[model samples]
Target: MPAMDTVVPPEGTILTERRGTLLLIGINRPAKRNGFTPRMYKELAEAYTLLDDDPDLRAGVLHAHGPHFTAGLDLPAMAPLMQRGEKAIPPGSVEPTDLGTPGYRRRGKPLVCAVQGITFTLGIELMLAADCVVAADDCRFSQLEVKRGIMATGGATLRMAERAGLGSALLYLLTGDEFGSAEALRLNFVQKVVPAGEQLAEAIRIAERIAAQAPLAVVATRLNALKAVEEGPLRAMGEFLAVQQRLSSSEDAAEGVRSFVEKRAARFTGR
Candidate 1:
């Protein structure tokens, strides 16, 4: 495993680190169980933008510095922002939550999340938006917006029903009850569950494996999958065929074929 050198953020809300082609983004407010103040939301949005804009970064692992992934929104601090209809991402930053305005956009690259301890409200939504999730066996998740006297506005209402069946999603959303990692996996909310303290390592391993593949191919695969979910399967298939045609002529595609024939590891340049 490559050691990560934490890069201090100016806002003191998030920590960033580079691991070869993988970017590590951590929620830094351990004392608050990594809760998102308005400032932390902006910092996290910037980090997501950075991951997308840098071609050198192929994947990202979003975890936290403390025992918990996040306590979700800091209601008192965020209430004012919500009233003003302000989103977590600023004007130019990428929206990781995918809950911004109509023009909001997310990075094209893959994101893997590692969750432990308490993960509530927006924390659950974040995992829904990510490509893959690795949760600690000790992790407890809740979409507690109803309990807080607010509906889940952080993409949970929209995504949870799709990821977890409508009946299952409503069961938890309506009650605002906590669920265990096993339930999360069964609901298809998270892909893997590991022992406590091992979630980050497992997440990083998945990210590294993704980064090792051809970057363009990875992006195309992700886009196709997302498109299928967003647009109906019929429309997504059309887009998928178009993308396949374009990638077939790329330099990386040629290298992929040659390497297969030569029986050696393929080197992709994302061209």
Candidate 2:
């Protein structure tokens, strides 16, 4: 984490703060079990946009204010909007789901998520979209949209199989079976499992580690890996030499070499 910078507090269903180069976005609708009402969905997408567009923000952490990360989308509130064929977000804004389509823009920056208690449906998709996830031991996860007579409209169907394999993804996703944090780890849904109350801190620590690295390299690394996953190995492999040459020519690369010879810490300026 960069040094704490006092940021003007955000007032909405989503709470955002700028701390150094990291953006902390928290779900604030705890009273309603942090459900994604249409308002909350739009606010979160705006926060994601801020993280992507602001050069100062290198990464982001998504957590919740209450005991649980979320109980999933407030279907009654969101169904009407979906029925009307309207996006909850305004025009020219990034959609939170990051589902590749004509209007939805993919996010370039990295995001880490922390979860505990009940995390269902959209909550699972949010984690699937994030770069990493820290799950508390108390978490109880489920994909309950099927039970509600709907299906996951987020990235779950597309990405879950990538992480957990097709059989495992269908095992729970099709059955709406609830699983614990340990199971989440075994399924590769979450990277780390911490005790209750430590999830957000663990996610912040991981984000801080990401922020301390060379910014351009970090972004390129993420993009390249995403390309391998989304596009294919051949597509990502074709650009390897080009990307390496570009990074080697950067000022940060020179500083990295100099710091190694001097036996000191490298100070990266995101150059």
Candidate 3:
């Protein structure tokens, strides 16, 4: 892992650092269990925007500074913002949750998350938005917005069911009960579960592996999978064929074939 001093987040709420082609974004308010303040939301959005815009950044890993991934939203502070219909990304920032203003969307690049201890409401939603997730064996997750007398507006209602199935999602979301990492894994909400202290390291390993692949191929794969989820499979299939045809003629594709025949590692320039 790169030292934390490499890149400092403009808003002190989040920490940003570059580890080779991977961007590490850590929720920095550990004293509050990394709870999301309004400022933190904007900081996170900015981080996602940077990851998407930077061609050199191939992947991103999101983790927290303390024992917990997050305790979820700071309801006392967020209630007013919600009531006033305030945007979370601020002006000129990409929306990480894809819930900002009309036409705002999540970044095209892939994101991986590491979760531990308490992960509630928006925390779970954030993981759902990520392409891959690593959770500590002791981690606890909940979508408790119903208990708070509010609905989950951070894409949980739409995403949780897609990940955990309709019956399981309602069993947890409707009751606001907590689930463990084992359950999360069974529900396909997370890709890996490790020992408590090893979650971040495992997540970083996964991100590094992703970053080593041909960047254009990785991005196209992510986009194709996302399209299958957002649009119907039939439409996504058509789009996938078109993308494959276009990518097959790229320099990276030629390099990949040449490297395979030569029995050497490929050095792709993402063309």
Candidate 4:
């Protein structure tokens, strides 16, 4: 494992580190159940931007340090912003880019998230941005913005339909209802549900497994999958191999061959 770099944010809200090839981002406001202040969002955005440029990072896992994964947005802090008429991005103001991070392009790397306890509104939105999600067995999920007389402004409004299908997404969004982990899993909103305390560890394990794979091939696979939806299935096959061919010369690819011939587990350097 490489030496991991730690990043600590003010207000003790964000904890970041590179664990092997897995970039772990922890929302650390346990007192308020990991609720987001505007500052937290800004910090998270900055972290994502930094991760986008890191060549050493092969995969990422979003996590929280607390009993509850998140209680969603801090209404007390955010009420004033809403009152001031500040809002999420205006419709069609710009094309959807990089999971709707204001002006940034998409980071092609795969992201996984571990969720537990009170997931609501923005908490659910966070999952929409992740490529895969794992929830604690007792976790709760909801999109309660409708109860507050507002609509989801995050990617959930768009991604949810594709992620969970129109019926399931609409039921939760329109009624502002909450569901438990079993329901979430059955509905395809979460990939796996582990015991309550094991979410982060399981997520990290998955990320590390992904990190051990061919980095370029992983990105290419994700791209082709997404492209098959937005572009076309016919184009995806060709695009997939074209990318895999380019990755054949990468250092990690060479290490994979050497390790196989040496009859030992491959120690990927993530080159």
Candidate 5:
């Protein structure tokens, strides 16, 4: 991480900003196509930890500061960190990929991603781990790790089959063939596609819509959905009734009912 006291953009690092209820995380190595150096990866995990722990933050947006979302890992500097594997993360840091590596926990909030240009390898995996994505029409994607003689250790191998189906994911993962934004949408890898330069705006718009809802309800919905996806539907179903009962007894639930009766928007305080 760069000196927290310094304002200049470092050679490679992540940038974070609090945008109302949304925490915006930007990949800031534009000079290197926003690739992740070891420090950047660590910083990103810390940023995710901030989003997870901060009560005032309702959601997060991950995007790059340049034309490309990311060119994957910065091989030269990243090689050393890759050797350390999960040990690369410091204690108390959130694993940005949400792989549930023992010490880290997934943020109990929604994350929306925006991408354009060279969205390859780790970039695609990052999106696969996120809730939804907005892609610029010019975006290109691929799981290029195989071409480099390595395979994706990121969540791609884990979540791709779940998100895009086994065959579709295998075709690209095995061959490392690049696909465009349209193909990404067809594979259900991206939720929305817009003209170049509109990705961030659309992503933030969606995140703001999420933030506008009842905070408690929003977190509950995300938690239940992730539980269903990560832990299997049976386990999620087993807890569904209890979860709903808890939410139904909250002050926000009463506000939801009163707002419905009065035909006004509900005011949620996350209580």
Candidate 6:
């Protein structure tokens, strides 16, 4: 495993390894209900970059080691930073980029999260970037920045609208109201809802399935799907074909073909 950044306070978070295929990121601030300090986001950004570059890791699972996933940003940590200027964040801070992009972008593999209790503002934004999410049935979801005297800047207006459609997305964005996990599932914001304690295990089962698939193919498919929604379909299709041409020439492609002909599971080497 790579050396994770030291920015993360040892008390607030923990990263546990699972078979070298699944990564478990746990928010440990139960006293704060896992509310994030600026340092935590900086640590998260660095951790994400580390995971992005790891060849052996096939999937990541974000879960909290507490009753709540996150209570949103730490107000005390954010207030001083905001007082400086919108863009005047301290070095290594992961406050939302004023430039309208998410703080860190993961290119390959999938991110699956298990959310429970409350997830507000930036929590919801992080979930938007995830490929799949499993929430406890009692999870409370919200976009509370508007009521907090600021607009949601963590890609909520753009990505949330795309995930939940204009009307449903607007309902939460406009009113800053709380919705249950059922509503999140109905709006297609989350993939599944399990009983409270089952979320992490369920997410791991899903991530393991994702890990078993052909890695390069998974990357190509996700890239195309994200592009189709954000960029034009033509551009997405063009990129898809370009990726296909390269992947088709890979060793994993050969293994898949051979495995199919042999009538067995493909032992994809992710070549």
On residues 123-185, what C-alpha lDDT tens digit does candidate 6 reach at each position?
887877778999999799989887888887667898778877898899999999999999999
In terms of lDDT, the poorest run of 10 residues in model 4 is 88-97
Model 5 sits at a Cα RMSD from the real structure of 2.9
Per-residue lDDT of model 4, residues 1-271, tens digit only: 1122254343446668877677788787777888888777666765665566688888888888767878888888777877897743333232112464454456678888999899988888887678789999989888989898888876777777877789888988899988999998887778999999888888888888888887776887788898886567887776756677777778878988998999988766656
Better of 2 and 5 by lDDT: 2
Off by over 4 Å in 6: 1-11, 85-106
Candidates in order, TM-scores: namely 0.95, 0.93, 0.93, 0.84, 0.94, 0.88
Q: What is the TM-score (0 to 1) of candidate 5? A: 0.94
- Encode model 5's per-residue lDDT on 1-271: one tens digit a residue: 1122244355587889888899999888877888877788888888988998898998899998878999998787778666766445686677778787776776678899999999998899888888889999999898989888887988898787887899998999899999999999998999999999999989999999998888888888888788898888998899888888989999989999999999998888778
Candidate 2 matches the true fold with a TM-score of: 0.93
Model 2, range 136-218, lDDT digits (tens) per residue?
99999998778988888888888889999999999988899999999999999999999999999899999999988888899
Question: In model 2, which runs have C-alpha deviations exceeding 4 angstroms?
Answer: 1-12
lDDT of 6 at 24: 70
Clashes of each: 0, 1, 0, 0, 0, 0
Answer with 4 or 6, whichever has the higher TM-score: 6
Ranking by TM-score: 1, 5, 3, 2, 6, 4
lDDT of 1 by residue, 1-271 (tens): 2332365343348778999999999888767777788889888988999999998999999998778889898888789988898776668678878554576666789999999999999899888889999999999999998888888987898888998889999999999999999999999999999999899999999999999888999999998888888877987888866798999999999999999999999999899
lDDT of each: 0.87, 0.87, 0.86, 0.76, 0.85, 0.76
lDDT of 4 at 168: 82
Looking at model 2, report the run of 10 residues with the lowest lDDT sum. 1-10
Q: What is the lDDT of residue 212 in candidate 4?
A: 81
For candidate 1, the lDDT comes to: 0.87
Pick by lDDT: which candidate is best? 1
